[model samples]
Target chain A: MVERTVRIGSTHGLHARPAKLFTQAAAASGAAVTIQKAGGAPVNAASILAVIAQGIDHGDDVTIVVDGGDESAVLDQLVELLSTDHDE
Target chain B: MMEIKGTGIGQGVAVGPVVRMAEALPEPVDRPSHLDPEREGERARASLSVVAAELANRGAKAGGAAKDVLEAQAMMAEDPSLIDEVTKLLATGKTAERAVYESFAAYRDLLAGMGGYMGERAADLDDISQRVIAHLLKLPAPGVPNPGHPFVLVARDLAPADTATLDLDQVLGLVTVDGGPTSHTAILAREKSIVAIVGATDAASLADGDTVVVACR
Candidate 1:
């Protein structure tokens, strides 16, 4: 399993549209990916409910876990995705 | 005999007794010491499956995107992973209620945070804020007097999501629990030419099925 930490950059943190977008991106990876807050149990990264349920806020640190052969590529893209906020 | 006011997010007027719509929290299940964790998990899975099936049937009757979302939720509520998690917690001597409480804490916090975040970006932020707050309001303890088919909805607040879900053709006016200038509900109501009132603290106390009028500035 490979893990990475990223900060939320969305103006609204990770709610509604942004959450939907992020989950879609994660789902596209085709990897068994899970996200969690520090000390939180991993949840399905592709489920909007699970993602929003993480209670991530702007500037909160989140750990992403990917376990599979393509873990490295998935981690790279997700980290890149989390780095920038969506446009208004 | 009196009128209460709130901002209206959707256009049009509806008159009826206020009927609060809120989901009930699930009750805790008792487990016997003789039951193995795996067996207990199967039981939880079965119960969740029944809930999901019931919700799916309800969604089909509802017929809309909202209905689709409910269907999706039913699936989540039945997820094997969710079942396993709940079972694991129960196996550790945690009561079902306690487990659900702990698990939902994160979900609740997330929703609250999301509500706050959405509020800041909202073009009509105030109305959305009001609606978000309404999520916390308790339905009248003794079945919030059914506003026997409310002709107009008087609320402390109404959010965009709530407005989106409401059928505007049925509402006569909207009164809010909280809101001020720049409330999205007011703006939207104005666009729809729906009568509305805002910033009324006692709006929720109006008698069920009372006929009232509103003047929107």
Candidate 2:
């Protein structure tokens, strides 16, 4: 498994639209991915409900773990997603 | 000649027959399943898949912002995390309908607990739960009604998924009993330029087929 920690960038945090974009990308990657707040239990990253329920606010640090299916590439893409402000 | 007051969205005065949207389905009973775990799991999966596909199709047809809202709802229907919960419940011999209900309710409560915009999202989960449960039970899914003509819609509140697919021409106006001006129903009404009055809790007493005048300032 490969993991990267990044701060959420959306101005309003991981709400529906941003959460949907992130979860859709994660599900499309065909990789086992999980996301969690720093020191929080990881949840399936492909679940929009789980992601939104985390209440990940802007600048909140989160760790995403990816296993199999081009781990490095998927991690890079998702990391970029987290670092960019989607609400802009 | 009842005077129902609420915050209006967009603007217009429309007069038409009232078409009441169905109430949300009752919570499923948590009874043990007579079918095997595998069979119950299959039933749950089938309903979820069907609901997901239907949402996706409606999203495609909807286009614009409605498309995004519907697409997100579709994702919720087949969310792998939710499926895992359903599967676990089935393993415990729960009926497919009850399993789906409890699983979605868990997330619903979590999101609602966040309050504000997140709390609004709880309605989306509720809509999906109703669709899946309706499918499992072979019942009509409660949502925007198609009464075969233009009408003023009345409901507790409109879910985004319902608003996304609303036939504007067919729905002359909207009166919701349980939504504030910032609710998804109001937002969509503004986006689509539909006349709407939200948070008119008194509107609940309005009966179907009652001709009412809806005027938005």
Candidate 3:
């Protein structure tokens, strides 16, 4: 299991569009991905409900875990996405 | 001539022509040969500031936690990158309306594409609604009066973003192009005793402004 930690650069946190965007990238990678806040139980990366329920606020540190083939590429793209400011 | 029903989020009864405040549709313009990049950039900044100010005012006035979402949208609207994009479009000789439209279109498409992405993984209505609302926020404001007109508001559905900005003084009734009794607009209208109907595709074709009486009952 490869784990990557990234900070959400979006101003509104993971409540709306940014959450949707992150979930999309996770789905596209087609890996068994789980995202969780620090000290929180990870949930399915593909489920919007599970994600929003996580209540991730802006600037929170989240650890994304990808367990599948080519996890490196998926992690790289996701890392890039999370680190970039998507306040738009 | 049917009086369909819906939930009224706000209170009030309106009877006017059906003035459609759909997406702002602007015609594309030819590119200018002599460009003033600096001036155009300032203009973009100025226009976006106006939109941002309105968004901020609305966000502050929003009545619930959803207000946070509106505030976020205001921030996005004021983003430097968007201003840059608008400025570039105008410098390319596009009209103000054209630049604004194209910039908003790009955000809309991005949000919609993201919605498509989430829709594939989650089929729940709430999930879909959130994504759709996010996309709507990315677009320029779709200012629909809450009471709309005394006429019925005809739409695909009353998106949360659309519902958020609705003025309670203009709507009399509603006829949606799509949606059902369980939809947000229906539930709210019903609660407020506002008449609303859904699932009528012809609602979009109605040309009446605030003067025509729409009986969706």
Candidate 4:
């Protein structure tokens, strides 16, 4: 599995809209992905419910894991999604 | 049959049946658990995990904006910090029901006490807590009703979770007895272009299936 840590950039954190956008991207990547808040248990990245439940706020560090299906490219794409402020 | 006046959200108008959102359940009594602390803790964990999984499943089916809200709610159901709180209460010999109730209440109070954005989160916490408690007791989760027909939702107020999952195509309008124009309910109505009347104190008397007209002058 390939992994990367990135800070949440949305001012409101990973609330409804941002979480939806991120989870949709992860699911569409056609790769297995998991995300965990810093020092938190990992949850399925494609599951919007699981991602929002983490209550990840802005400035929080989260680790993203991507396994299979062009891991590096998918990881970079997810990392960019995490770092962008979708709330704005 | 009577016209009630209040602040209307957005310019749209609608007419339909009224469906009331269920009220929050009363707090669980601080009673000792008949079961062993270990057993009660296990029960609490099982309920929490079940509710979490259920929320995730609902989110998966919902998609769009509703998908995100449901997903977040699922996370809240099994939140590590929240689970920690439940475990601590159960260790003290509290019943699983009370443990879940108190744990969620603690976080709800904390967030409500913070005000602003955090204050808004308190409602979400309340919704999750209710769902977990309902699961433990085998009761229907308290939320917007699906009467199988288009209706106007009347409630004391709408929580973020309730509003997020509302079926817009079926909801002709919204009316709340409490909450201001800036409340989450109003904002959602405005965003979705749904007709809404908020802070209608007299709306408290509105009953289920009561026909009402929502209009703005």
Predicted structure 3: clash tally: 42
Model 3: how far residue A49 lies from native, Å: 20
lDDT of 3 by residue, A9-35 (tens): 888677666765777678678798889
lDDT of 2 by residue, B1-217 (tens): 6799988888789999999998877889988899999999999999999999999998898788888889999999999889999999899999999999999999899889999778878878988999999999999887889999999999999887788888988999999998887888988899888999999989999999999999988
Model 2 alpha-carbon drift over 4 Å, by segment? none
**Candidate 4 share of real interface contacts:** 0.17
Please write out the lDDT profile of model 2 over residues A45-71, one tens digit for every residue.
Answer: 999988888889999999999999999
What is each predicted model's overall lDDT from 0 to 1? 0.56, 0.91, 0.59, 0.82
Candidate 4 ranges with C-alpha deviation above 4 Å? A1-9, A12-88
Residue B206 accuracy (lDDT) in model 3: 68
Point out where model 3 deviates above 4 Å.
A1-13, A17-88, B1-19, B33-35, B88-96, B116-142, B145-149, B155-162, B178-195, B209-217
Best prediction by TM-score: 2
The digit string of per-residue lDDT tens for model 4 on A41-77 reads: 9988886545655678999999999998999999998
The best candidate by DockQ is 2
Candidate 4: docking tier: incorrect
Q: What are the per-model numbers of colliding residue pairs?
A: 30, 0, 42, 3
**Model 3 residue B213 CA deviation in Å:** 8.4
Give the per-residue lDDT digits (tens) of candidate 3, residues B1-217: 5343443333444566675646433334445525366665555566566655765576577556335545545555554344566777877776554565566555545444455333322222222223223333354344464442244566666644455555556666666776666665565566446666666665666664535444442
Native-to-model Cα distance after best TM-score fit, residue B197 in candidate 1, in Å: 3.7
What is the interface root-mean-square deviation of candidate 2?
A: 0.8
